[model samples]
Target: MREPHRTDSATATRDTRPVPCRPADARRTVRHAVAERCRDRALTCAGQALDDALLVTSELTTNAILHGGGITGFDVAVDSGGVRVSVSDRSDDVPVATARPDEPDRCAAGGRGWPIVCRLARDVRVACLPCGGKCITAVVPLR
Candidate 1:
């Protein structure tokens, strides 16, 4: 398992690194990174929040692979209240949340990723990078 590169500042501790764009590998890598960082920071990672964070990480990384062309970077930060997960991709298009269709036949083949991420994380944000890419961040509170 690869560990995240840690950087310490006055305000907070951040572990940021780049993860591969492959779906299966990216999901596993992100989960491992989150778990390891949480452990190192003495943060709780053995409850509903951990589960939710892992799920959100998986969904976000998968979305990057499927929709964002590829993942360019990833970061997990330990904040005062919670941990923030940021996944950057080469595509600048932000994600949109759409309600699930009542009829299965009317539903699109895909589009549930952002909703799932929003539901799992306490907060979510998207920032457009200077390189014309975008980074989607989700924060999961420790409980």
Candidate 2:
């Protein structure tokens, strides 16, 4: 099993304080937190659901870093319902799913992650923070 990276907090599930600078860090944080907190719950146990959650995590964090200026806050919480991953960045503009790669106008390298996130996450929300930027929360139900 992978050990959760500790920062100001003593454990992974409790260490929601770090603002991940990279997508991998955010994904790791989500993985550890969700795995630790939701292991006993049948619907929250690890499997394809966990993989979907990680993919959503990657997309959100990568988008934040690439388009939202930078990640200002990151957090994850696990419950009987599912794992909720929230990522806040400096862009007030909301995320939009663009055209597919095969589309004539869409950029080939990008525009795919957002749709993947939308598809995998059961509930997706984008809220503009009062301070600045926006926070995207995605809940991926484990099965």
In terms of lDDT, which candidate is strongest? 2
Worst 10 residues of 2 by lDDT: 1-10
lDDT of 2 by residue, 27-139 (tens): 88887887676544434467798888899999999999999999988888776556778888999989887656588865567888888999999998888887788888888
Cα distance off (Å), candidate 1, residue 55: 0.6
What's the C-alpha lDDT at position 66 in model 2? 94
Identify the runs in model 1 with alpha carbons over 4 angstroms from their true place: 1-13, 16-18, 23-43, 100-102, 105-109
What TM-score does each of the candidates earn?
A: 0.74, 0.81
Candidate 2 clash pair list = none
TM-score of 2: 0.81
> Candidates' lDDT values, in order?
0.72, 0.78
Q: For model 1, what is the alpha-carbon lDDT of residue 20?
A: 60
